[model samples]
Target: MEPPSTCPPDLDGPTIDIVVADPGWHRLIPNAGTIVRRAAHAAGMEGTIVLSSNRVVRGLNGRHRGKNKPTNVLTYEHPAPEIILALGVVRAEAAAQGRRPAHHLAHLVVHGALHLNGEDHDHPGDARRMEMAESRILHRIGVPNPWKRA
Candidate 1:
């Protein structure tokens, strides 16, 4: 993995726990815990962030989202707030979008955090608002807006 990416210093916010369920995550993004904490804090969320494999994520997706495919990220609110990310899917998407894997991972973490906080992109208006919030949060944490075209 590339050297751990730099992130702003931690600030006062909700406490978050990061669980690296898959060792492969280290090969995709170094210092992932820092990224997840910063992004989750910026999104004003507190929860467990699970860095998992594609197979595990696919099973969760199929059971929860009704799609038998590995998604970049997924968030759950029941029992406790939790966000799951698939390393392979995240890395591939980052490569496809020509973005640094760390940046994409941060974006998805923030996205999942927003979802847990009641930000939904199911409709166009909602999507715009959610994207704007994401851009704001990402910018605060030094990541470029994912919605902005290069």
Candidate 2:
């Protein structure tokens, strides 16, 4: 169940490069690059996505965000705009939140792309707007509302 190397033909949007460093999680997410590309197109952004392990994400968090913990996703703008996803954190969070891994991954990709597009959730209003946009994009992709209570 290796992830697809290329995006779907219909997804004619921004280019995305998905580098999966964790082989175990690779089977869990098929067509991950397509998902990220769709989200980026929906959010009107162009970037890359790195699908990695929790350890890598944790290290990045400690160095960049100063949080010193693994997060589901992180978006960075320097060197090159890109989104880094921690598969372990994403799987755990999705299970806890009762979301399918694919759906949860879609949500995170959309969230990261939004951040790359300058959408921030640091404030209540901004958060609301970003969430709404995420919902809309997810809906368009046929994924259920990730924020909806299970």
Candidate 3:
């Protein structure tokens, strides 16, 4: 297993940002953030990893993507000026899925962090690489392969 990257004086590893105004967002922010931050750390990203959720599904749908009463998870990730790993999780969907909010949160966190680290699944080959990487990362951290369960 790759060792967690060290934080150099000139480099920062993922910073967390919480932007969800909805009071109903997950209480386990730290839990999810820790999982994602560690994963990003393992991936060798030298930046801040922000953790947050969203509520304006309409605006998100129009700006970010999709408009189907929101989604269980969404991540807006990019490099430069610090990476924004926005995680928007629909609380109702989590409840409907009978998942512990924390699990869903952890999954989204890893997913977003991976994106910031340049991992993508836009195509079959890319997806396979991402899923395989995610599976290995999640497994190492004791979380089941999220895609495998889904």
What is the clash count for each candidate, in the order shown? 0, 0, 10
Error of 2 at 48 (Å): 0.8
What CA RMSD would you report for each candidate?
4.4, 3.1, 7.9
- Indicate which candidate wins on lDDT: 1
Model 2 lDDT per residue over 1-150, tens place:
455243334445566666666765558877776676676677676767788889999999999889999999999988888888898899999898878898899899889988888899999999999899999988988889876766
lDDT of 3: 0.53
* TM-score of each prediction: 0.90, 0.87, 0.59
Q: Is candidate 1 or candidate 3 better by TM-score?
A: 1
Task: Please name the candidate that would achieve the greatest TM-score relative to the true structure.
Answer: 1
Whole-model lDDT values for every prediction: 0.87, 0.81, 0.53
Q: 32-86, model 1: which lDDT tens digit per residue? A: 8788888888888887888888999999999988999999998999999999999
lDDT (Cα, 0-100) at 84 in candidate 3: 32
* Per-residue lDDT over 1-150 for candidate 3, one digit per residue giving the tens place of the 0 to 100 score: 222232223235544433333323335443444555555555455455433334454455556665644444444544442333233453454577776666555565566667766778899999899888877776776766667656
